[model samples]
Target: MITIPFSFIPPKILERLSKHFLNWGAFLEKLFPFLQQELGKANIKISAKQYLAMSFIATFFLFLFLGFCLTIIFIESGKVLGGIFIALFLSLFVFFMQSNYPKILANRRIKKLDADLLGALRAIMIQLNSGVPLFETLVITSKQDFGELSKEIKIAVDEISGGVPQIDALERMALRNPSPYFRRALWQIINAMKEGSLINKVIENIIINLNKEQIVQIEKYGSQLSPVAMFYMMAAVIMPALGIIFLVVIVSFIELDEIVVKGIFWGLLGFVMFIQFIFMGIIKSKRPSLLEE
Candidate 1:
């Protein structure tokens, strides 16, 4: 379900081309069998074959477009082969990134679910303690604003309303969800139900365990931050400044052309910016979902 708002080709044309590439898509599915499960976890409502076909078609067009632009630039410098090679490399990189997009999205959903899960579970426990039926508690939870957790619960609520057994609905939700904690909680609830144990006690135990896990996550994040901060300072700040100063001294001794000097400085600036961007992403990725601001 990828959409390009300002694409060079029409959607209809892309769809047509994608259909023709279905065989290639099937081949890709064979090579990376996990894509099917990832697509389900990401909630992307398309068969893996169709998705891979679309991805291949889009990437193919992207390669052609980049190849053309780079060819034009390199033609001016009589380096067409270099342009082709660079374009091929970039195209392959984009294709691999596209292939991993589903897993990335699934992980994001998992984080959002984990961030809200404790509160949602506590809400359910309170409702149950007040004598609300399990189905009613689920229905109420589905109506609340617990982000992705609420949406997932709503799916179970709908399934239960449609004559599916409550346990079966919960099982389905747990199976498809990417959040391990959510699945564990659901399985615990299912066990409690089957054993006819007090659901409140089970929920309370789950909340306590989740709280302990969050504490560990916070401590782990704190332990990681110091080293990451040091690395960021070295790579993005001190190194760049020192490197620029050293480059200036070297350039003063060398008789480089003005354009070449400017190019070198610009390239260094780009590299520093890239380093800063990478470090920032690493820090953000290391942040615990429950601690997300």
Candidate 2:
């Protein structure tokens, strides 16, 4: 579970402001229908309206801060209009980014769950094969250090302990979790339990399927990495270096002012850094989540 970062305002003040904008937030929630489910998947306990309201508040503060700083810079350069435009653009960017933050956290949780799922399932299978009851197996799995998977199992265990039927608890877990593989495994277990089949046999089949899926993911990732690496090298390394040299030559031939040359170099540096950052993110995002650490 992640807490939304809005340190610019006190939590109490932010909460108050968010409540004041609840109607607007409700309208925005209707525009982005999936937000409520994403909040659950991300383990954020707040309602969609509350979260969206806070996002708007944070974005509003960000815009004010940027406007202040950029106004000073643009005032010196006699470009106040340009500063306003840039600040508006940045504020909107931040709002959209905040809107997707729950989904990002959900994806992160899915990756953590996927990374530890196989080991956790194997532990469960072993315990069951040793004649441990399903509920006890789940409790033991929940106590183990299986990262996010352990935490999710703990939730189900808690639900069962609180008088929920095992099948119903497991079904709720499957429905709320963002990982397809985890949900599929849970559904299979629920089905096996319903049919009075051997739980160990169902778990074994799930392990085999997961292993095959992991292998396919690895193969696809390998095929993707070659081209992605090539693109990264061209875009982030060779192009930046060559472009800098070309720009330097042009500036020299044109007898550009020293300040202008410095500004151009700084802009190119920023552009190169941006390209490198984007390529790094792409490479990390392409990594197969199921790979063993």
Candidate 3:
């Protein structure tokens, strides 16, 4: 393996730190299972142990870098207590980022899967109604260009071909997937198989419900965009422009120190960028997962 600068802490050390020293098992028991499940759904090949190790290592390095920068800034500025506060804040930020990385990946995967779900499900229903067996329908779907859903169904097809029963394989896939809609469809298919109900009709009903859900989501998103766009405009554009103009006007009237005036200008710029990032996150969070484009 290629050695990196941060490789001083061996993987074993990180693993042991995660397992015994931190007692992560006790505190993380609730969240780690879902993390593992998300890893599977996201098609990430790393184990939860490996994922945790990587996250810790990355977090440590990130904090290390931030600490160095803050130390220099605080020492030059002669603010020892502020340095400590900044270090604590960075630690908390690292903790949050480490804890949520897997969830972020899983959410991305779920979005991609949902984006293509309607088309995939419609194709499956068509194949089933045409008298194709469930296994063949999945295989055929897997051969298509449905993105993550296709890749996931391909995994199910591989499992079924490897001697796992179709229903069991489908159930396993559904259990590991992050989307409730995906799981509900799989459960209905499983039930249809058990009860000898029409799989085609079950899938058709799912299609209709999913379509209704998409329509509702579109309406909600449209309603949501107005306020978000207004906030973005005020915080990121209008506020910054007004602040810079006010600062310039004040500078023209008073003899402020060059350092203080520069600091205000740069600080305002950073705040504007920060607000833009917050609005970007809000937009991402509000976006419906089922949107394909």
Residue-pair clashes per candidate: 0, 0, 0
Candidate 1: pairs in clash: none
Worst window of 10 by summed lDDT in candidate 1: 1-10
- Candidate 1 at 47: error in angstroms? 2.1
Residue 156 deviation, candidate 2, in Å?
1.5
Error at 230, model 1, angstroms: 1.8
lDDT value, residue 39 of candidate 2: 90
As for lDDT, the candidate ahead, 2 or 3, is 2
What is the per-residue lDDT of model 3 for residues 232-273, given as tens digits with 9 covering 90 to 100? 899899989999899989989999999999999899989988
- Local accuracy of candidate 1 as per-residue lDDT tens digits, 1-293: 55522246676676677888889999998977999898888888877887778777777788889999999999999999999999889877877887888888888888898889988999999999999999999999999989899999999999999999988998999998989999999999999998999999999999999889889998999999999989988987898889889888988898889898899889888988998898888887887876434
Ranking by lDDT: 2, 1, 3
lDDT per residue for candidate 2 within 118-201, as digits (tens), equals 999999999999999999999999999999999999999999999999999999999888899999999999999999999999
Task: Write down the RMSD of all candidates, one decimal each.
Answer: 2.1, 2.0, 4.0
TM-score of each: 0.92, 0.92, 0.80
Candidate numbers sorted by TM-score from highest down: 1, 2, 3
Give me the candidate number with maximum TM-score: 1
Give lDDT for model 2: 0.89
For each candidate in the order shown, give its overall lDDT on alpha carbons.
0.86, 0.89, 0.79
